[model samples]
Target: MENRHAPDSLDSIYSIDSLRARHQQLAAQEPRLRIRERALRLGVPEAALVAAGCGVHARPLAGTAQALFRELGTLGPLMALSRNDAAVHERHGRYLDIQADGPVGLVLGPDIDLRLFFNSWKHFYAVSENGRHSLQFFDRSGEAVHKVYRTEHTDGAAWDAYVERFATEAGLPVVAEPPGAPEQAEAPDDAGALRSHWLGLTDTHDFFAMLRHFKVSRLGALRAAGADLAQPVAGDAVEAMLGAAAASGLPIMCFVANRGIVQIHTGPVKRLLRTGPWFNVLDDTFNLHLNTEAVASSWVVNKPTSDGWVTSLELYGADGELIVQFFGERKPGKPELPAWRSLMASLCAQPLAA
Candidate 1:
C-alpha cells in the first residue's frame, strides 16, 4: 500500500487519481497509521480512498452484505477483525453458521463469533496488497465496521476465487451523511420504578429495552440503579482481573465493537503483552489490542437474569463510548460462574464514594 507511484503533482488531490496517489504517499510515510486513520487525516471518507483505487488492488464488492458474508465459509480458515477507535479484535477461524434475519446477523461458530447489525453496513471491498488480502466492510459514513482477512491457514487460491466472484467495477461509493449530535434526554425522575424493572429483569437482553422505556442513557441508568446493581470500580482492576483469569485458567468472554458489528472472543486468553498504550492479548487464534489510555471509567455491573445474576466489567471512553467489556464465559441456560462472582466480589470490595 506504500507509494503506489505518485501522481504528476499533488494538484486536484480529491480526484480519483490524485486521491490514490496521496493515499499511498501517506501510507508509505506513515506506515503505522491505518487506512481509516490516513483517510481521516486526508479529510475524506475512507471508502472514497478505497473507491479511488478500484481498478488496482482494490475491488468494489457487490450483493447484499449477508450474501457476500455467506461465501466466506467456502474459502477455508481465515481471520475476522472488528475494531473501534480504542480497541481492535482479531479472531482466526473459518466463517461458519452465519444467520441473518431482517437487519441483524449472527455468526455462531466455535472459533469466529460475531453479532452484526446490517443496517449500519454499507461499502464492501476486496483489497489485496503485497500478497495480503482482506474483504473490508464500512458503514454508511465510510467508517469500517468489520473485515475478513486471509490468514496463513487460508488457501490463497480459494481466497482469490471468492474475491473474483464477488468483485464489481470500481467507483466511489455513495455514502450517507454523518449523524447530528445526540439529544440528551432529561434524566427520568422515576429512578425507583426503573430500578424495580431492572432488578426484576428475567434476562440481560431485556436491559436495553428497560433503558429505552425509561429514556435514560446506559451510564445514567447505572448511576440510578444503586450500588448493588452497578458501581464504579478502580480503573486499574482490568489488569488484576486478567492476571487472575489467566492464572486460574478461567475462560471469559470479551466483546469489542463500533457502530456496525460486535466481535466476541470466547475461551481463554493466554499471552499478555503491553506495548505503549495498548494492552494486548496475543493468543494464536484470538488477539485483542486495547488502548487502555482511552479508558475514562470502569464499572462492575450486575444484571439479574432468570438463570441467575450475571456480572460484567464495563469500560467506557472519555466520550462515553463503550471501549470494551468482559464477562465470565457462559451459555444461555447456564448460571453465572460462582468463581467469577467471587473474583468480582474481591475486585469490587472497594467502590467510589458518595
Candidate 2:
C-alpha cells in the first residue's frame, strides 16, 4: 500500500507498450502478484495498470460512479467488491435499493450493502479478462474505490447491455495524484473533557462529529475517553471473535472500507479459513479476506446509541489506518444484542495491562 508516489501523469511515466512490458516482466518475476501490487512496483496507481490495457480487454467507461449505480440493478446477481490495504469484502447479491444524493449514496439491497463517497471516485472501466467481466472504479490517485464483479448467476445480457451503454473511447490518459497520508490522532484534550464528549454521544454515527469538534483522532479520542469506554485487546481478537460467532450462530456486522466506499456484511459467519497470513470468511453469499498479520492494534469499543450501548471490535494497521470493524447486527431503533455484547466481552473482557 505504499502508493505514496507523488501524483503524476501515469501516461508520462509509462507508454502503453512500456507499461505492458514492465508489468509482464514483473508478473513473470512474481507470478502471484496482483495488478495492484504490480502498479505499486511500477510507481503508479493501480488504475494505470488497468488503463494500459484500455481499448483491449479493458474499456474505459463513461460517466460518474453515481450515474453508473442507477442502472446497476440491471446487472442482477453479482458480487460487489471493496477493500482497503488489509482487508477485502465481497458480497454476492442483486444490486437493488440504490439511492444517491449529491456525492453520497447507498446500495441497501439485502445481499449487497454499500456506503459510497462519490467525491473520491474519479475513473471507471469495464474490464474483461479470461471471460470474466467487472466494472472497476478508481480514485484520483488511481487507488481502487470499488469494483462490481459478475458472478455465475449474473445476468449476462444485462451486463453486456450496461457496458455497451457506458463504454466509451480508449479513455483519458491514466492520471493519478499520490494518495494522501493516513490520518493520525493528535494529542487529544484532557481526559475528562474527552470523556464528556464520549458520554454525550447518543448516536454512534455522531462519533465522527464529536471527533471533529474536539479535533482528536479516532484512536486519540479512544485513548482519552477512559478505559470504561475503549480498551486495547489482543490483536488476534478478530480471529477469536469471528470464530466464536460462527460457532454460536451469532449474527454480526462487518465493515470494510477504503477512502471511496464502505461495504458491510450482516449475518452469521459460517465458515472460516486461514491461508498464509490471511484469514478468510467463505460463506455462500459473502466472503471476507483479511491480512491478519498486518493488524497493529485491536480495540473493543462501546458507544452509546439511542437504543443502548453498542459494541464494536476495531482493527488498525501499524500506521493507525483502520483495517476493518465489527459490531452486532442491530438497527437504529433496536437495542444492541445482548449476545453480541457477551461475545465481545468474553473475547477481551479485561483491558490490556499498562
Q: What is the TM-score of each candidate against the true structure?
A: 0.90, 0.94
lDDT of 2 by residue, 149-228 (tens): 99889889999999999999867666666565545456575768878877878899899888877777788887777677
Candidate 1 lDDT score relative to the true structure? 0.81
lDDT of 2 at 122: 84
Error of 1 at 338 (Å): 1.2
* Regions of candidate 1 where Cα sits further than 4 Å from its true position: 1-14, 54-56, 171-176, 180-186, 350-354
Question: Which stretches in model 2 have alpha-carbon errors above 4 Å?
Answer: 1-3, 7-12, 54-56, 179-185, 349-354
The residue pairs found clashing in candidate 1 are none
How many pairs of residues in model 1 come into backbone collision? 0
